[model samples]
Target: MHAANVPTASPLRTILLCFIVAILEGLDLQAVGVVAPAMAATFQLDSAALGWVFSAGLIGLLPGAVFGGWLADRFGRKKVLIGAVILFGLFSLLTAYSASYEQLLAARLFTGLGMGAALPILIALSSEVASVGLRNMAVSLTYCGVPLGGAIAALIGLFSVSGDWRFVFYVGGVAPLLIAVLLMLWLPDSRAYRDQGLPLRDTSQALMGQGRGFSTLLLWCSCFCTLTILYMLLNWLPTLLIERGVSHLDSSVIQVLFNIGGVLGTLLAGRLMDKGRALMAVVLAYLGMFAALAALGMVEQLQGLYMAGMLAGACAVGGQLILYALAPRIYPAKVRATGVGAAVAVGRLGSMSGPMLAGKLLAAGAGMSGLLLAVSPLVAIAALSAATLLGRDK
Candidate 1:
C-alpha cells in the first residue's frame, strides 16, 4: 500500500536498492566481531586492545553519519550512497590485506566511515520513496537487510572459507563493489529530492525547533539504549556463551538464530507500524526483550538458551529497526537525513560503549548472567523513551 499523497512510478525498486546497501553495511559491521578470535591471535592483541579495535569502527561512524547526511541533503541521495558504498568497499579490501594490527584498525575505521555514511542516505531514500502511510513499513523492510547481512556473516563465520578470516573480509569487500556498480546503473534518487531543489541549509538545528525538542531528545535516548543492548549482544554474545560452558558451534548457532529472529521481527514490526501501532510495537518488543535477556542469563539448557536468544534478537534488534522507521517521520524532508543522522550518531556512541563495557566487566570477573543483568536497565530506558516520545503519528 502506498501513501496516496506521495506519488512515484515505482517505489519498489528504490526500496530494494536501499535494502541491498543496508545488507552490505551489516556484513561489514558484524565482520569484526565474527572474526575477533582470529584477529586477536594473528595480531597478538589483548582483550583491552581488541576492545579498542571494535570501538575504532564505531568511532569512525560518528562523523560519517553526520557528514554523510549533510552531504545527501546538500548534494543528492543517490550520489552520496554510491560514493559511500565504494568507500566502504575499497576500505574493506584494505582490511583483508592489512598486515599489522594497526593497519587492520585503520582499515576498519575507514570502512566504518563508509558504512555509517551509507545508512542515513538509505534511510532517507526508503522514507522519501514511500507514501506517508507506508513510511515505517518501507524503512523496516529496508533495515531488515541488516539482520539478514549479520546472518550471512555468521554463516560464513561458522563454516570458514579457506579456514582464514581474511577470506571473510574479501567476500565482504568484493560483494559491495559489485553492488555499487548496480546501484550506479539502476538506483533512483528520490523524486521528491530531485523536485524540491531546496537550497542547502543547516537543518540539524530544526530538529530541536518546531516544538520538537523533547521528541528529539527522547528519540536519541531510545536509540542509545536500544543500540547498547543490540551491540553488546552482537559483539560479545558468542564469547559470553562460550564462557558459560556452551560449545563454540552452539554459540554461533545461537547468534545466527538471533539474527534470523531479527529479520522476522523487523518484518512483523513493519506490518504493525503500518496499522498505526509503532509505539506499542516498540514497547512490547523491549518488554519482551527484558524477559528474554533475563531468561537467557539464567537458563542453562541449550534448547532453552536458543529459544531465549531468538526472542531477544527479535525484540532488541527488531525494536532498533522501529526507531529507524520512526526517524524520518520526526522531521521535514529537508532535515530528515540530518535528524536521522543525529539520532544514529548518538546510537553509534552506545554501540561503541556496549562492547567496551562488556569487555571491562568480563575482565573484572563478571559472568555471563551478571553482564546480562547489568544491561537489563537499558531495555527499560528504551521502553520508557518510546512511550514518552512526542509528535508520534498515531
Candidate 2:
C-alpha cells in the first residue's frame, strides 16, 4: 500500500496525538537549557566552549527543519513526525550517558536535528486537521506545549537539584518515546497532503521558486529577525534580571510569570487570527513588546519589572504564533510544510546568534538599557514587514 494510503484516525485523536508530540518535542528544546549550568560545572567548560555547544544544536536545527518539511511532504506528516520523535528520544537518551563535553554536545546537535523536523510537521498537521474556525486555536494549543515543556523542565530541576543533570535527560528522552508510541497508534496524515499529492520534487521546487528574489529574501530576513529576538529573550531574560540585582529565586518566579503570559497570549492570538486580523494582531503585539522592553529597562521597581516581563513575554512569543498562523496561508498546500520549514530553518540562524550577540554586548560593557534598546528594533522591523504583507490574501 502507498504510504499516504495508511488509514487515517479521527481528527480529535489526531490533534491530541499532535499535542502530545509537541510536549515531547518541547521537553527536548528546554532540556539543554535546564542542564547547561550543571553540565558546565561538571566539565569545567569555559563560556566560549559552552556557547559553541549551545550553538551546535541550533545549527543542526536549521537543516533538520527544512529536511523534515520535505520528508513530511514526500512521505507523510504522520510518518515523518513519528520518525522525528523516535530519533529525538534515542539521542536524548544518549545525551544522558555522555562522559565528555564533546559527546554531550554531539548528542544535543543530533537531538536538535530531530526537534527541528518535529515542529513544522506538527504545525502543518494541526493546521490541516483543524476546522476552519479552529485552525489557529489548534495550532496555538500545539505551540503552547513549548512553554509547558520548559515549565516541566524547571519543575524537574527544582525537585532533582542534587547535581543529577542526567535525570533531566532521562525524563526528556523517555517522555518522547512514550509519545511516539502513541502517535504511531493514533496520529493521521494531513488531508492537505492527500489532496495536493505533494511529492518530494514539488516541495523542493516550491521552496526554491522565489529563490534569490527580493520578496523571498525579505521574508527570510523577517523570519530571522523575529526568531532571534524571541530566542534571545527566552534564553537570557531570567539571567538578565538576576544581573540587575533580582534574586535568583525572584528571577525564576518572574520567568514563570513570563511563561504564563506566553500561554495566554498564544491563545489570544489564535482567536484574533481566526477573526481575520492576523496582521493587526502582530503589529499590536510588536508595539506591546517594544513598550514592555522599554519599561523593563527604565523601571527600577520590582513590581514594574514583573509587569513588563509578563507583557513582553506575551507579546514577543505571541507574535511568533501569529507568524506560524500566517505561514500555511502564505504558501501553496503542495509546498506548505517546506515553506514553513524553510522559514523556521532560516530563523534558527537568528536563534543561534541572539545569545552570542547578547554575550558579546555584555562583554563590551553594554548595560541592560543598551542591550534592550538594541533588540527593540527587530520587533519594529517585523511589525513593518507584517504591515507590508497585509494585503496578500491567504
Candidate 3:
C-alpha cells in the first residue's frame, strides 16, 4: 500500500488530528454567539431579527450537510473537511466587511454551508479510524472540541467586549483557515474508506437513495431530541440568566461553566461508552439533566443558578455525546457516513427550531421557569426513544 493508503499513525495522533478538526468544526458552529450581540447593536436589530440571523446559518446547514456527506463519500473525508473549512473561513472573513444587515445575513448563510459540511465528515473520519471497542471513545473525544471551541469563543467575547465585534469574527474565521491548512498537511485519508473499497458513487447512492432500517429511525429520533435540548439551552442560557436578575458578566460566566461542564461530560461519557454501557450511561445523564434543569428553574440566586447550569450542562450536553457515539453503530459500514449525516441533518432542524420556539415563549412572557420546564419533556421523550430502540435490539 502507498503511505497515504496506510493508517500508520499512533492512535493518539489520530485522536489529536480528529480533535483539531473538531475544534475547527465547532468554532464554525459557535463563532456566531461571540458576535451576535455586537451584530444586533451594530445593525440596530431586535430580538426577532437576531433570531432570524442566527437561524439563517442553521437553515443553510441542512443542505450543506447533505451535500457534504456526498462529497465525503465521493472525494474523501479529508478533502471535504478541508474544502469546508476554507469555504467557511473565507466567508467568515468577508462577514467582517458587510455593509448592511442583508449583507451580514447573506454572509452568515454562506458561512453555514461550510459549517454544515464539517461535522458529519469529522464524525465519519473519527469513527472509521477507531477500533471497534474504542470507537465511541474516539468519537466522544473528537466532539469534546465543541465545548472547548465555545469556551474559547466566550473568552474572546470577554476580551473583545469593548473592541469592535468584527475582530471576533476575524479571529473565528482565520483560525479555522490555519487549521484547514494543517489538516491538509497532517491528516491522512481514512484507512477504513480504502479498505472497504468504497467508491464515491457507491457511497453517494447509499446516502441519497433507499437505504432505511429501524435502527436508522431510532437514531434519527434520538439525535433530534438531543440536539433540540442542547441548542435550546445554549441559545437561551445567558439571556435566561439575565431574566433572573443576573448581571451580563455573571451570565457570561455561567455560560462558560455550562460549556466547561460539556467538556467534562463528553470525556466522562466517552469513558463509559468505551466500557460498553452507552445506553445505560445516556439514561443516567438525561435523568441528571432533568433534575438540574428543574433546579435551575427554581433557583433565584446567581450562585445557585450557576451550579444548576453546570449540572444541566454536564448532563444535557453529555447526552449529546452519547447520541453521537451510538449513531455510528446503528448503520452498516456501507452507509455509515450517510446514516450519520442524515441524522445530523434532521437534528439541525430541531436545533434551528429550538431557539425560535424558546424565544417565542419568552416573548409571550413565559419567564425562565417556563422556558426551562418546556425542554424537560423533550429530554424524557429522547430517553424513552433510546430505551425503546436499544431494548428492541436486545
With candidate 3 superimposed using the best TM-score fit, by how many Å does residue 377's alpha carbon deviate from the native? 1.8
Candidate achieving higher TM-score, 2 or 3:
2
Worst 10 residues of 1 by lDDT: 1-10
Query: TM-scores of all models?
Result: 0.94, 0.93, 0.92
**TM-score quality measure for candidate 2:** 0.93
Steric clash pairs (candidate 3): none
lDDT for 293 (candidate 2): 83
**lDDT tens digits by residue: candidate 3, 1-394:** 3655554666667678778766765665677787887789988999778877887888878888878866776666778888988888888887888888898889889888987888777788888878878887888888898888887777777656547878767876888889887777777877765565655455545544454466567777877888887898888888777877888888888888888888888888888888877677877788988888888789777788778878878887788787777776665565566667777898888898788788888889888888878777888888887777666544
Winner by lDDT:
1
Top TM-score: which candidate number?
1
Q: If both were scored by lDDT, which would come out higher, candidate 1 or candidate 3? A: 1
Off by over 4 Å in 3: 1-7, 198-212, 392-394
How much is the lDDT of residue 199 in candidate 3? 57
Model 1: residues with Cα > 4 Å off, grouped in runs: 1-9, 390-392
